[model samples]
Target: MRSRGTYYLVYPLVIFLLLVLLFPFFVMISTSLKPVKEVYANPPHWIPQTIHLTNFSDIWGKYPLGSYFKNSFIVAVGTTIINMLLCIPAAYAIARLRFVGKNFMMYLFLIVQMFSPLIVVISLFKVISRLGLLDNLLALILTNGVFTLAFAIWLLSGYFRGIPKEIEEAALIDGCSRFQTITRILLPIAMPGVVTTVIYTFISAWNEFMFALTFITSMEKRPLTLGLYNFIGRWAVQWQYLMAAAFLALIPVVILFMLIERELVQGLAGGAVKG
Candidate 1:
């Protein structure tokens, strides 16, 4: 049996977590379904007079949604592919390889993240302009890829370091090449880390708003974040449509999170415990 003090301590934390996190999601769903009338009712309505399934249909049909989805998918998927391809090997190298300046290089990458995004805007814009990558999907892809690559390498490096070297040594003795050692041996063992890196890169690319807003100039090239701006007209706002758009925009990310939730948990715990 739990002690009274332990129960008292844990119960309130549980309540706090649920209220802070789950409550907003509940409100989001409620707002997504509720009509504007009930959504903004004087007292506020937790549940609507009538549930609206058509919101999803409406946004998809009404907005330039296909283009938004395409743009987001391109960036998200491209970033995921690049981060995993580079970071997995980079992580393995940092974790297992002995070389000059390895720690220094890792430190540099972490330091880059410490600065605010605003700091890099001028240089990145100049470079992007010179390369003619501004307002391009590939630009978003490359931006997200480069931005998240450092963290992926760092996180996966930690997870990789936590794994025993005996596994790779065994595979090496079995005549595996360095690449083979990574692909056939280390990767299977560190699948959790790779999965974590993939989800993190994908979600970061997907949810990225500021860079997307700035880099993407065309209406057709806009991701969901920019696409959402269309619903809020200058003079009058379409509250219902905005809510619907927000809900729809949230769906893919929610699904992605659900699929990799286990890895996310493992990744979070790994970082918290070791980092």
Candidate 2:
């Protein structure tokens, strides 16, 4: 009886929380479909009087949306690749090797996450300028990779630790090299964690605004976050167009989450337990 009563109480609270979470998305969709006049109506409304589908089509021509998406994709993919390349090796070492400062190194990575990017942006700006990487997509890729590396290493190492050592030893006894064992054996088992790290790194790189704003100067090189500025005028903001572009920007991330939802959940749960 208590369990039944608890379910009744919990259902409403869960529904309310879900509604709260989805309300912004609902607003974004509603505003995206609204005509300009409807957007500025005296009392804002939940639904549009007339659906304006042109906002979706118009955003393409009005702004360099394609270029922005391309730039974002390049930066995001580059960051994820670099992150994985560096993280996999480091994580393997931390998980498998009995090394000095192993625990300290793990904690250090967590410490790195505690600091905000704002603290280091100025120093990074000087370094980027000195390297002549300013206004370059490579600059964003590198910075994003560096910032996200700590968490990736920490998570991947935890996932690696969770796996049985006997498996790797058996492969080693069978004459498989360390590298081969990592590539052919351990990686497949740890794929959920890898996918989680990839998705996290990709999203971080995609949504990054501060570093992009600080580093990128060329209009053509700007990512989606910066491209959104085109909708903001001196006096008036293009609410409909902005919302449309924002909604479109969300599609890739939403699709990625949908496809990898199972792996991501397992990765997170596994990492938490193992870490």
Candidate 3:
């Protein structure tokens, strides 16, 4: 009873932290709905006297937001797919296959993670220019895939290693080929890890701003992150419209979380353990 009573003391702190984290989102939504005049009014209002619903419609029609959204979706999906195809085989090989320099190869993947995209932006830009991929969504897709590959392999390999070898041996003894053993038996069990990887890759590619800004020259090729620039000029900032677009931009990510929220939690937990 005493231990249970002590737990009540932590509830207030948790609630306080939740409110603190949520406050900025609340402010953004509030600003998005406020009229331009009310935005800078003295003693800013948390709730607007008049909500401006036109912000959404205006921004949509005025800017190439739809194109930006399409480009982001294309790049994000492409990055996730390429990462999965490449990482799955590499992770499986590292976790299950025994060969010389296997440990060295694992170390190499970890080393790659230490290098951020920002560090090689100039070199990458030159390469993309040579490939004639500048201003193309393909450029973002390819670059994101390469940047995210190291983490995907490291994560998936850990999950792959956690599965019992006896299960694979049983499948093999039952006349299943190596491919069949992996596809039918191992994949279903390792789905949590896969989901985790998908979410990470998708989000990273979607939110990537530096490469998108640098590589994309055409207005229509820009992603949602770059689309926010439409509301800013050299002299003025359209705070309301900017916030409105930003709020709308968050919807897809929120829906994604809602859809796979369960699998993500399970994957993270399961991926933590080593076989």
Best by lDDT: 2
Q: How close to the true structure is residue 212 of candidate 3, measured as C-alpha lDDT?
A: 89
Q: Estimate each model's TM-score.
A: 0.85, 0.89, 0.86
TM accuracy, model 3: 0.86
For residues 123-159, what per-residue lDDT tens digits would candidate 2 score against the true structure? 9999999999999999999999999999888778878
Q: List the residue pairs that clash in candidate 2.
A: none
Candidate 1 vs candidate 3: which has greater lDDT? 3
Q: How do all the candidates rank in terms of lDDT, highest first?
A: 2, 3, 1
Tens digit of per-residue lDDT, candidate 1, span 79-171 = 899778888878888999999999799889777755666778778888888999988988888888888888788778888898899978997
Per-residue CA lDDT of candidate 3, range 1-275, in tens? 56977779778889899999999899889989988899888988999899988887887887788888888999999999999999999999999999999999988987886688898999999999999999999999999999999978888887899899899999899999999988998889999878878887898899899998899888888999987875575367778878888998898787766766664455445545423
Which of 1 and 2 is the better model by lDDT? 2
Cα displacement (Å) at residue 138, model 3 = 0.7
Q: Flag clash pairs in model 1.
A: none
Candidate 1 lands at a TM-score of: 0.85
